[model samples]
Target chain A: MHKSLRSTLWILIATLGATAISIIAISRGESINALWFIIAALCVYSIAYRFYAAWIAATVLAVDSTRATPAERFDNGRDFVPTHKWIVFGHHFAAIAGPGPLVGPTLAAQFGYLPGTLWILFGAVLGGCVQDMVTLFLSTRRDAKSLGQMARDELGAIGGTAALIATFSIMIILIAVLGLVVVNAMKHSPWATFTVSATIPIAMLVGIYMRYLRPGQVLEASALGVVLLLMSVVGGRYIDEHDNLRLLFDHEGLTLAWSIMAYGFAAAILPVWLLLAPRDYLSTYMKIGTITLLAVAIILLQPNIKMPAITQFIDGSGPIFGGKLFPFVFITIACGAISGFHSLIASGTTPKLLSNERDICMIGYGGMLLESFVAIMAMIAATVLEPGVYFAINSSAGAVGSNALDAVTKISAWGYPVTVEQMENLAKQMGETTLFARTGGAPSLAVGMASIFGKAFGDGLLAIWYHFAIMFEAIFILTTLDAGTRVGRFMLQDMLGNIWPKMGETSWTPSVILTSSIVVAGWGYFLYIGVIDPNGGVNILWPLFGIANQMLAAIALCVATGILVKSNKLKHAWITAAPLTWLAIITTTAAWQKIASPDIKIGFFSAATDLADKLASGTLPAAKAAIAPQLIFNLQLDAWLTLTFVILLWIIILDMLRVCWRCVTGKPILPLTESAYKPSSLLDDWVRD
Target chain B: MIIKLKTLWKIIRQLSGDDAYEVYLKNFAKHHCNHNNTDCSTPLSKADFFKRWQDEKWQGIKRCC
Candidate 1:
């Protein structure tokens, strides 16, 4: 009774606090303290993790503590070694946390804080966390199957094929959008470009150090890499100050785009240990350290969120991306909320390392909850910037003319007023010539982070803090870019092998170069188009990436729901089914709008038609007319891609439903595929104790 | 003081994957010591094992968004 009382009191306090905080956060207000977002996220995560996640782990999945995991059964010293639960959690978190959580929330803040914050908090607890934990548990039970293989086995051929196509397309768009972000961040900024450029040689140096001097010393090498990386962040300022040095590093968007493509290609085909491995190691350390510092700094600073609780952009006239708040916020902020990408990592990547089935809830659900908090922090970071500055940095010359004065006038007319002098002052303070029309979320987020960090640590070193944040984000984006390119190469090879078997040979140099080029070309085309886009490439690429990501999540949920039905747990399938239903509704809605809406700004097909008509009638503006034909083609291509995503999404969902219906009707369906249980020895030790 | 510091240092090594080879050998010995027979397959060398590990880790969808 005493324990029950304590528990009840705990629930009551958290519930009341969560309700009170959310109400204040959402109610019509301006300049709400950013601290409210932090409190609200914490309250929601703790409650959901404790109750909903625990119930799913205990009742729905029936995770048996005594059941031996695959790691215990197949203790290969390489992949399947049993690990401490906390260590597994950390590794899992590191693998899943990327620029997605950081960049998505930063972009979604264009709609203001309320929508993104609520979505991140509620979406993760109910949708993303459940999806991840259930997928991890089910995959562990099935011998750590890949997402594609699980779909093939449980949901049949159509579902499996859809999953494969979704993953490949997601990779392409994800890499391209990330490349666009990097290009936008580094373009014309010598400090960021130089710091980012320095990372390659720095990583290689550490790789050689680890390989030759102290074999297998990852910690030592990464420490050396981190120290060197920090120095470059400082070194960038020196380069920026020197005119000749600055000219060498500074480049346009198109040049940076090509350079990034070259870097991605090289990283893909080059030996992994040299660049990819060492960079991954070094970046993971920096990711953890920098994210922790940002968290502490946010708490210490208690900065006010300058953006309103809801913006006029909610109706879909925002310069960042063109979409309504309802589904667009959900679509834009998939990673922190219900990212489909986590399902890929959750299934085969970390499941095999678990020693106990019970650890799935913590490692999967808890890890995502932490990522959601990071998303909340990002939203706070972006929102803390003056709304006028946010728009100035995220807008494109296409929306707000090419010059700073014209851009200021256009943005000021939007009710979020700014001046040319204010923009110039900010740029000068941050050690840049101009922050206008930066477009991608990276530069703005860096400005926000630098502001918070400068106030919290030392107000004197704003430029260094700003560059550090940029380097931190660049490291993440570039890491994802190369790793994704390599993975895409393998997938393409795996498919191409069906036509010509020799193309699948990974070690064959000809096959390697051929497949790598194909994958690079796939994203490089999109990246190049994005750079030339006057309205800012982010407006085009980010939504498409978001849709692709959510579609992948939809595929993952379909697989999870199908497995649950096969397991004869169709009644409790709502845990996966609800989120699956939400994703299906959201992605299809967003895709439909993108493809069919008459508004040229919101609809891909409409935009293409408008541009084609303009070109035909000779009414196109001078700058636009030059790029008119290509723009029309790209718009149509994007429309077709959106249509394809929707079609694939429905196919998978319908197949899952069909299998589910067959199960409910007592028809013959695939039997549940859990591995035979082996009682763990750890249970015996507990009994002895 | 030294013991605490040593424990922390070991953890850093483990987390950064620096101690993978040592951990692999220890686990292998624990799994095989009871057999005392040649049927126990020889474990991979440190260099070969690291190579195998990198190939697998870098392949597939290793990282997320």
Candidate 2:
């Protein structure tokens, strides 16, 4: 086909798919098929990748293929080694993806699928991908500087400090919310608890094998690790079947939360090779394989979307979490759409290994497009289950009541009718004692995945598939939990190093222990409170994580825009500035509501005040009265933190505006400091190998 | 036919990280010491090079959310 004709064909396909999707979503009083959502997403991504991404690469970044990259100019066989583009893409994608994309969309399914799906598709292409690519390009030109270093160099000291503080704060909240998810998924479920616990030993065994038995044999070690992991997944079923063994592994949410906290602390203090590295390698492979399998299964099965286009939850009466759809949906679905975390990875590792500057288009922008697709798949998975079941699984006991009958009655009154026996049967089939209030989004997603896989693969394997999905999600979440804690410790040491010079040394024993303890406690306190909260921890922790993450993204975009202005690329400044302005609005509104709204359910301060009023009036029940003070304190603390995030965002935004003003007024702020231009002499194509 | 199958196997091994040391040795010989040898065989032993690479790769802020 001719080139223009090919473009025309693609445009036609995209238009058709979009039209079909909007019609399905908007049509009232009828159920829609999941296949339309998948088709719509795939078509839109194809068009976006081919056209919008191409335009950005050519016009905005002006990628020059002949220019020598830092990886080529400073090829030292260590950090600056030039790598194959696909390998770099894989590594970058693995680093950025976590349980965030999967869980966020699952939770946001409360407003149905239309709003979340649309935001994910538009957000990644316009906001997330642009931030990542521009940041990667800017950092690469400066010899692969990290985000914080770039902020300090391009903006000023204040911007740099705010960026560093945002990174540290986001890391703590990210870990806490992730830990809560794992805790909720494992609570009182012997099958999931046993399977997840088995991964630690499997990783340690693989680590020792790689270190002592067969050094550098990563493939062999990870292969063995994967096989053993599968065996453990199967073995967990038998363990759950055995009455005595099940009793040994079964525990409540609070106990599991404590165990996870201890695990995070120990994993941080221990050597990387022992548990963190090995587990990371295993999970990377599993992550890719599982996501690929899910995409395939969804396409093959084409399950119908049971949830409506819009639900009553859009009004902010959502049982899963509070806040209306406008800003909350964008906040809820961060990772899949435009996660700020990817900016760190883009500026951190991907730029260092870029053999050719052109590969930036693929690694930075394309990698995020794939993550958005994962979020779309998560939406599909959440909506595939009966709406009643999704609500029953995701809503907390406090919202829907504790028992199965009460849950059924409450959910039915809300419009979606489900029977107690039906819930029990589904739980028994999935090999769980009860799935009434799983609360964390993991179990509901697993149920969705299991149904899709079971329908596509075979019958009587729902339990196996369900356990496998749980293990898959748990592996990645645990990987993030341990890795985030370690990063947090390093950042803490760097901060404390200013006061006590000796504390900066990473290898010092007391410094390591002290920093690790502080880092663990920072997130651990939130995880403990979340586990004890009657409404489920995700309702509190997830929004905090989203706000913190978007704040970091705002900082990253500010740095990008500042760099562009300094470099005299004023014409293309809108590429970064537009997203930065929109994110500032969304995050500011969400933070303001969280801090000062009068609604107890949505606002942190209001919730605290309401609880206090109840206690003072002696209207609280005896059981609730005991923990009311703590809950109030937590709410108040969360309100303050939200305010802090908003303040940091404004500080960085103002710093960026200062740089822009200096550029516009010709005040000669500072000259651009890109690395000396070097021409590539290598005759070999990095990709041809 | 057999050669094609063997080539496929080699590519799979390379992608799955089985041939990392060999690739590293080639790159090291070509770029690290300024030899620019086409064959790119390095003086450092395979085990030593692999150990060094692992240590440097695992160091700071490697994962994200």
Candidate 3:
């Protein structure tokens, strides 16, 4: 076909597809099929990746095919050797993706699928992919320097320090909320508990096999690991049936929370090669395989979405988590739309492995596009459940009384009618005793995934499929927990080393254990409080995680925009500045509301005051009054943290603006810190030999 | 079709690090020598190269959420 004709064909298809999506999104009076969402997201992604991404690559970043990347120029056989672009794409995708994209969208489905779905589709095109690509480009030019170094070199010390603090804060909250999700998922469910616990031994076995038995045979070890992992999922079913085994594995939320904390601490102190690395290998393959299966199942099953496009919960009265649709949805769906975390991965390892500068578009923008698709799948999975069931699973016992009957009545009052019998029956079918108050997004997402898998594969295997999905989600979450704790420990050591240099020696046994304990304790406290909170811990921790994640993203954009302005590309600075400005507005509003809103459900201060008032008036029951003081304290602590985040966000934004001012005023601005240009003999089309 | 399948297999192997030693050797041959000299120094053995590669790849903030 002629080039123009091919272009015309793509344009036509994109237009038709987008139009179809808009129609589906707006036609909320009638139920829409899940397949419509799949088609719409896929079409929109194709158009955005092909057209918008191409324009940005050519016009904004001017990604040159001829430019030799750091990998090619540095050419160290270990870290910087040139490799295939697809390999870098896969590696980057695996690193940047985790439970965030999967869980965030599932959580945001509370306001109905429309809000989260639209944001994810358009947000990735305009915000997420742009951040990843621009950061990748900037880091590649600067010899694959980390985000912190780039922030300092470009935006000066204030921005650098702010970015560093934000990264550490985000890591703590990220791990805490993730741990909370795992605890909630496993709480009082023998099958889930057994399956998740089985992964640790399986990972250890794989670790030993790779280390002592086969040594560097990753594929072989991973193959064995995957088989054992599947067996564990099956073994969980048997354990669930065995009276003694069920008693051993089944535990309430608090006990499970402590167990997770202990596991994280142990995982952090252990050698990476023994536990973390092997689990990572198995999880990567699992992640890829599961995501693939989900995409295929969504297409094949094409189930109708039971939830409406717009729900009344958009008015800040959502039972899942509170906040109006504006900032809450954006923050809740961070990883799918635009995660600040990806900027870290973009600058950390992906830039170091880029074989050619041109591959940045595919590896950066394209990788995020794929992750966003995963988020879309999660959204589909969540919305496919009846709205009554979704709310019953996600809402806490505190919100809708403790009994299943109370949950049904409350949910039905909101217009989506469900019954206790229906809930019990579904739970039985899925091989669980109860699914009420799963609270975290993981179990509901697993329910969603299992539905698709069971419907597509075999109906009789719903229980197995559900456990399998739970295992997949839990594996990734645990991977993040272990890795996040290690990273947080290192960051703490770096800070503590300022006071005591000996503490920073990563190899020192005392230093390792001390820092690991402190880091685990920091997040473990939040996890403990969350586990004990009457209104599920997700409500308190997830928003904090979202806000902190977005704050880091805002800092990343600041660094990117600063680099652009310093290079005299002032006109092109809007590419990064646009997202930065929106993030600044949204994060500030979310933080302010979280701290000051009068609604007890939404605001930390108000909740604290309300609890105290209730206690003083002697209106609360003894059980509630006993926990009121601690609840008030937790709320007050959250308010202070929100204020701190707000302050950190402004500090970096003001620093970035100051740099922009200098550039505009013709004052001597900081010089660009990119490496000196060197000509290369490598062809742009060079492939791995 | 068989040829295409073989090519696909090779590509997958190359990307997934199944062929890491082979790729590293090729990279070494391509870039090791300075001043246009060929084979100026022998590259590390495959076992040594693989160990170093694995270590470098896993260090320092490799996972994200």
Candidate 4:
């Protein structure tokens, strides 16, 4: 009784503190400090982890610490190791932490910081963390089934196929959007282009060292790679100082787009030991190191949030991306909050490494909490910039204007005053030709990161810091681009193998090249149009990516809820059902809006129609007219894609609901047997460091 | 203090997969001794181990966006 009372008191205190900080964050103060965002997020995460997640593990799932997991049962000593919880946590976090959280929050900051901040907190605690933890628990219970297998077993064929197709489509859209981000960051900027290009040779050298020079020496090769990467950052400045070398490295969007597509194709077909493995190591290390550095710098520096609590863009005229703050903010910041993609990681290799079933709460729920915190830091970084400058960097030329002065005038007229001189000085400070209309969130994030690092460390190396940030983001984004392409190739081959056995052989050169090109071309077409789109392709692609990602989350939740209802624990089914319901509402509404909204800025079909009319009437300029037909086709294609996603989403949700109804009404359903799950365990013995 | 730092480094190596081959060898030998079995087949070489590890690791949906 005494222990229970004390725990209750602790929970009460945590709740009260979190509420106060959140209120302060929500209220419009003169200028809120960035530290408040950090504090609020920490308070909410701890409270959720302690009370909510622990309850779910104990009561909802009754996770048995003594129950031997697949890792312990199988004991392969290779892929299935019964690892400690902290090690598992690190691996899981690294797997899920990508450009999604950083770029999503930065783009959503256009609606001001509050909407994104609240969603990142609320969405992760109630939705994202729950989905990850439950999916991890379910997968662990079933000898570590992948998500598609779980869906197929629990919900039937329609749900399984929908889940698989959603995962594949989102992978394509995710890579195309991320590729656009890298292109925008590297285009027309000699320093950034030089630094990013240096990573290829750097990765290849590390690959050769790992493969032949000193086999199994990952740590040493990665350390050497880090040194070379930093040297290239410094060397980029040298190249930038030399006009001819700078010109050679500098290229426009079209050139970078083709280069990235070719790189993806090469990575997909090349042996994993050569390029992908070495690149993954370097990116994982850099991602962890840079995120840690950013967190510490933000704490030490404590920059003030310069944007308002809510901006006029809340009503839907945001410069960065279109659509109202209602469904769009939720869509724009998908990963940092309740990303559907985390479900994939939760159900993937992470589950197969679990030693104790009870560790699922920490490795899954707690891991997602940390990822959400990274999103909070990204939000702080973006909002800490001057609002006018943020708009100037992220807005498209089609939205703002063709030149720096006009962009500044237009942004200033919206009540956030900026000048051409200020932007020019910032560009020079960052070693760039221009900063206006970078438009894909990478350049602005680099600037924000540079400013923070410059203030916290020293102001002397702002230009180098800027390029370092760019290089880091590009490295993370490019690794995802290639790894995703390779995975998509395997997925396509698997699907096609069902039809033609010859096509299924992953080692055949003909099969490899065919699938690799098809996968590359799948995303490359989107990347190509995104490169040439004058209205800023991210404006369309990011939302589509968000919708598709959320659809996957919905499918994962359906499977979890179906299992809950089938296990006769219908009372606890709301834990997954609530998030599934919310995702369904958001994805369905967002898809409908993208398809049918009358506003040309928000809807794909409307944009296509608007452009087609302009083309017919000869109102478009010669340059716009030349690209008008392709843009129209692309927009209509996006609309059709969104419609398909909506249909697939409903089919999965309704099918799962049908399965649950059958179980509820005593009808026969797919039986989950005791051989798949057994209960035994105590939790106290497993917390050792 | 030195021991503690060593332990921390070991943990980092474990998590980053820097020490994967070492762990695999230890586990392989231990499993060979399990159940009084006397198979005594050679474990994979360092080069082959790394190659197989990469092939298996990338075969599934590993990374996220």
Which candidate, 1 or 3, would have the higher DockQ against the true structure? 1
Query: lDDT tens string, model 3, A1-689?
Result: 99999999898878878776887678866778887787788788888888888888898878777777788787765677677788889899999999999999999998988989999988888889999999999999999999998998888889889999999999999999999998988988999999899899989998888667776677788889999999999999999999898999989888898899999999998988788988998899999999999988988888888888889999999988999998899989899999999989999688777878878899989999999999999999998999999999999999898988989999999999899998998899889989999988999999999989999998899999999999999998999999899988888888889999999888799999999999999899899889888899898899999999999889889998888887778888888899889999999999999999999889999999999999999999898888888888999999999999999999999999999899889888768888877765567346644
**Candidate 3 Cα deviation (angstroms), residue A103:** 0.9
Highest DockQ model number: 4
Candidate 3: residue pairs that collide: none
Candidate 3 regions with alpha-carbon error over 4 angstroms: A684-689, B29-50
lDDT of 2 by residue, A1-689 (tens): 99999988987988887786787668676777777877787787778888888898898778888888888877766567677777788878888888889999999999988899899988998999888888888888889989998888878789989989999999999999988988888989999999999999999999898777887788889999999999999999999999899998999888998899899999999988898989999999899999999999988888888888789999999999999997999999999988888888988688877888888888888889889889999999999889999999999998999888988999999999899998899999999988988988999999999999999998689999999999999999999999899989989999999999999999899999999999999999999889888999799999999999999999999999888878778898899999999999999999999998898889998899889999999998898899889899999999999999999999999988988998899886756768887887653764436
Model 3 TM-score (2 dp): 0.97
Give candidate 2 regions above 4 Å deviation.
Answer: B1-16, B31-44
Error of 4 at B55 (Å): 2.0
TM-score of each: 0.97, 0.97, 0.97, 0.97
TM-score of chain B of each: 0.71, 0.54, 0.73, 0.77
Quick one: ranking by DockQ, best first?
4, 1, 2, 3
Chain B of candidate 4 achieves a TM-score of 0.77
| Deviation (Å) of A480 in candidate 2 | 0.3
- Candidate 3, residue A619: the lDDT equals 100
Off by over 4 Å in 1: A684-689, B1-7, B33-45
Give Cα distance to truth, residue A634, candidate 4, Å: 0.8
Worst 10 residues of 1 chain A by lDDT: A680-689
How many angstroms is residue A186 displaced in model 1 relative to the true structure, after the best TM-score fit? 0.5
lDDT per residue for candidate 1 within A49-131, as digits (tens), equals 88899999998999999888887777776778777777788889999999999999989998988888889988999999988
DockQ of all models, two decimals each: 0.53, 0.44, 0.42, 0.56
Of candidate 3 chain A, the 10-residue stretch with the lowest lDDT total is A680-689
